[model samples]
Target: MYLLLVFRAMRNFIVVGHKATTTPSFSLEDIPGTSGRLDILCRAVTAAFVISHGIRKDVCVYLVLLGGEIPKTIRLVGETLRHLNPDERTTAALLKKALAVPATPEWAMSTSGIFVRTGGLAEVLTDLKDAKLIYLREDGADIRGLDAPGKDSSLSGEAAFILGDHTGMTPEEEALIEQAGARVVSLGATSLHADHCIVLINWFLDTNVFMSG
Candidate 1:
């Protein structure tokens, strides 16, 4: 029953890659890492949590760190609200802690509604879909615009989206997402930071009453 409850609580997601974790240690001082930038990850996760209405929703956020001592991946389910402090401090602190955590192949609740696991861009994408959630990669391909009217209808079932970090998705990462069979999606032509992209995506989806309903 506990397992079943966890499954039902799953919400749409937004995965972003932080290819800058080239730091040798898991310390916060090392954040915005020489390689993996925690600042980007912090902002991205915070933006994903604080959507248009300011009401928190169930959303999973993935930070794929490529510059870490071991190239780790961290997934945080939306349940970190209780511990989330104003500003990005709380998020930053949690990420610091998550970085020091060991890798887990299965989804494990790090706290209440929050879950974390160690993996990479492709692994997380594959796992979420295997759990029956629809995954989409935000891209500029011939795909549909997230804000396009009626575009919401095309995305049925639980869904998740992926974006790139400061340096943007690596060519290899793009191929990984593509290979996973994720539908390519776009959000206009202008390029924005990963955190900004997340806010816009959530706002667009909220305007459609996707999660609220």
Candidate 2:
């Protein structure tokens, strides 16, 4: 019930990483090279909530790390989020702090608004079971023309957006996303970085893409 309420009032971005470490051992200085492309996830996190003068309290970013045997998830809530910077490295630093803390079976707070827990793609899907799922892809229905992609009366905007890292989702990971009923939508004919895709998605919703209709 709480999650449903949150989803109805906010937008969610979930970035799945196949190689991001589940531990705090990742080096912040070299995120992409040492942290298994965690820099990509960091950039996506920054793009999700950093507005011109303030952060969107209604936004959230879920980092699903699948490098270890047990998956780790970081939930960055914008409502209570503080000390966030617009750059990727600063966000990476925040992630590093979250990873340094101990995440129990349940969600543990690493900072003001960051929560870390033990779960991955399956866990995220369950958490957002009641929300509309948007799967960002290179070849699917164009995002601007679809209602399944959100911005309808149900939630007023899109719910959860699922994305892949630099290497993209594995065949099995894709299967899990398909089973979750995520609507695959494309931004354009050419593929863009995950961070860039996020900014575009936000723009469509913020500017009311329904103007075309």
Candidate 3:
């Protein structure tokens, strides 16, 4: 049953890097410095998909970049994910390359499992496809006391955890999230890196699912 749940469940991590570059002009060596703290999103990608021995094939990661004139969303689906190692630099390269692709309001495949779209947080919220949208906030309800995730019919057995970058979401962004009716959840009092939070959420679901199954 544990193995069954592990193979069948789907988990999504969406990180909004408000200052991250939307264009592909940032230097590879300065992802954090020049890319406007894109290093944070890169680390979150590692946490979402990387695991011992292999990738988490059941996971998908969303990166929203809002620095350039237009906001862009880069998606990485782990089931068919390839060419992604567990390093931040290479991941940064992939993200940069994805942004370099031709702009499309619709999703355009930059690589095998990665996709780039010309939109931001609001568009993503409407594309949930019955997935429950959860906002990770320090003041929300504690995440420790939740039921098994991705099992509700109303949600079509899907859920996505949305996080903000180092600078956190702007007030306007926060208002948009709340307006979308996001279920806010807390990780604790102390602040944590977005990547670390992703790890914690993944572990919470994986462990709880294994135990429950």
Q: Provide the TM-score for each candidate, comma-separated.
A: 0.74, 0.88, 0.90
Clashes within 3 Å, all models in order: 9, 0, 0
C-alpha lDDT of candidate 3 relative to the true structure: 0.84
Ranking by lDDT: 3, 2, 1
Which lDDT value does model 3 have at 93? 91
Query: Is 2 or 3 the stronger prediction by lDDT?
Result: 3
- Which residue pairs of candidate 1 clash? 20-35, 20-36, 21-35, 21-36, 21-67, 21-68, 22-35, 22-67, 32-38
After aligning candidate 3 to the native by TM-score, how far in Å is the CA of 106 from where it should be?
1.0
Candidate 2 lDDT score relative to the true structure: 0.83
Best by TM-score: 3
Clashing pairs in 2: none
Model 1 agreement with the true structure over 67-91: per-residue lDDT tens digits: 6545566676665544764456567
- Model 2, range 1-213, lDDT digits (tens) per residue? 355332335789999989998877877777888887888888898889999999988788999998877899999999999989998888988888998888776999999999999989988998997777888899977875664333453225448889998887788878888899888888988979999999987787676534212
Ranking the candidates on TM-score from highest down gives 3, 2, 1
Error of 3 at 5 (Å): 7.9
Pairs that collide in candidate 3 are none
